[model samples]
Target: MTPKLVAGIEPPYYTAVFTSVRPDAPEGYAETSVRMQEIVREVPGFLGYESARTPGGIGITVAYFRDLEALDKWRLDTEHQAAKRYGREHWYDSYSVHIGKVERSYGFERE
Candidate 1:
């Protein structure tokens, strides 16, 4: 299945592609994730995201933003920092973050 796209965003935006493997006992993971989602939405220039996970526990979330500065702000936010630390210490077995510029995009829908 395809990951759902964040709707209504124009092209030429930035995307942060986050992929991770979940740890066995992820205490507080869900709460932190929900809080981070809420926090990012309140950040200026924040767009939206698409997320999915495989049955084996690999997950991916692609978050879009208006520009590098907005992405940077989100990255540097204090709450985000805490979340990252928590992930490193408790939740993620391995992960990767890829930031890229989206110059153009197109899609189709079948009803």
Candidate 2:
């Protein structure tokens, strides 16, 4: 696929979306969650991740990256596979991942 090129930055960036539903998880669940996130850090195109837990049954995560190929590598990674298995059996009740290209982003944080 020909990557979409933006004027300000590079092309073919990666975006990962992970959603889940964990109704009644025990305490320390979030603590363990941190460990899971660390695994993603080792993935090739793991740019960044954002997450939230809602009232009813909603868990969402988005991970950004510099290239889709890197994202694919992450998806097929061995440790990632194990984490997925663990999520299926224990960590998460349900989850999903949506990936996309980041065409543009702006920052103006005070330095």
Candidate 3:
């Protein structure tokens, strides 16, 4: 399947980059991941997201938000909080999150 690339995003936005490694037995991870994706779209400041995973169990998800306040809202979402707990307890072997402000972005696509 072709991964969809986020487009039309301007600078001065915020991004939450989540990098993780899955445990050997990742029970419920896929479902929770899908749920989180759905929930994020409902967030007020949500812009878009890009995600990829390697066969070696390493995954990275970059979520875009309109601003810091919007990013904070997602950070404090109840369902998302629960998913984080579940990931810590059951799904992930390890993970890291980095928040950044995008000053500029550029890309190209061949038509």
Candidate 4:
């Protein structure tokens, strides 16, 4: 499968990088993840996101936002909070979230 790469975004945005180690038995994880992705799109300052998971159960999702305020809204979203709780209880064995500002970014694509 082709990896999805977020492109054309200007600099000075914020990114929330979520990395996780999933448990062998991931019951509701996939559904919740899809729902969260849908929900984030409705947020005011949402830019775009890129995500991928390895066969070994390690996953990373990077969500982009226009600025810090938009990132905060996502952090405090009610449904997202619930999803986080559920993931902690049932889905993720371990996880980490890194939020940072992208002062500059560049990329190249082949035709």
Candidate 5:
């Protein structure tokens, strides 16, 4: 079974969406990714995160934060900086990051 990569977050929050193409050789990608996940949880204002990937090597990760300040801090984290460097050097072929404020959101779930 596949996991759900969508987080349940409240409004008046910030979202960081990262879209990227997989690297040809992901040597330490998995380990680094797990480490980053753990690190983010410890950061203040971190709400949640979700991720998904396609068979074609394209992927997206969405992380929620209480505000832009928290998001900016996460972006400058030392460990995350290392990961970004690694990604540019060996992991990602291409990528883009977009941060936005979610003013209103609505959804439906049926049992």
Candidate 6:
């Protein structure tokens, strides 16, 4: 697990966490992941994303650059916008988005 109180990172980053209801989504999981990956690549501040499915729903967290404008652009991205509509029309039952800026962060690393 990542630290709750992180500190000391050179460049700032954006932390976005998204959680959504699966509601009979097993068949489309692969398709959804592929679409998301494609969209992320198109976004200006494209970074990385992690996702997992549980009995109740799917959880996705994407870490990207420190640009609110870029983030907003992604929100309104053509493909993504269409996907959002499709999600509301079909894919997801419900979802929530949480966005925050990472001012300073630190974590103990041991491998």
Task: Give per-model TM-scores.
Answer: 0.91, 0.67, 0.93, 0.93, 0.90, 0.74
Give the C-alpha miss distance for residue 11 in model 1, angstroms: 2.0
Where does model 6 exceed 4 Å of error?
Answer: 1-9, 24-29
Put down candidate 2 lDDT per residue, 56-94, tens digits, no spaces. 779887777778777877788786677678667876677
Clashes in model 3: which pairs? Answer: none
Alpha carbon lDDT of each predicted model: 0.89, 0.69, 0.89, 0.89, 0.87, 0.69
Candidate 5 regions with alpha-carbon error over 4 angstroms: 1-8
Error of 5 at 31 (Å): 0.4
All candidates: CA RMSD in angstroms? 2.1, 7.5, 1.4, 1.4, 1.8, 4.3
Task: Assess the local accuracy of residue 8 in candidate 5 as a C-alpha lDDT between 0 and 100.
Answer: 59
The residue-by-residue lDDT of candidate 5 on 1-111, one tens digit each, is 555544456789999999999854378888888899999998899998888788889999999999988998899999999889978998888999999999987765554
**In model 1, where do residues sit more than 4 Å from their true spots?**
1-4
Clashing pairs in 4: none
Candidate 3 achieves a global lDDT of 0.89
Q: Which scores greater on TM-score, model 3 or model 5?
A: 3
Prediction-by-prediction clash tally: 0, 0, 0, 0, 0, 3
Say which prediction, candidate 2 or candidate 6, comes out ahead on TM-score.
6
lDDT of 3 at 4: 65
Q: Which tens-of-lDDT digit does each residue in 41-89 have in candidate 1?
A: 9989899999888878899999999999999999999999989997898
**What shift in Å separates residue 3 of candidate 5 from its native position after superposition?**
3.8
Which stretch of 10 consecutive residues in model 2 shows the poorest summed lDDT?
2-11
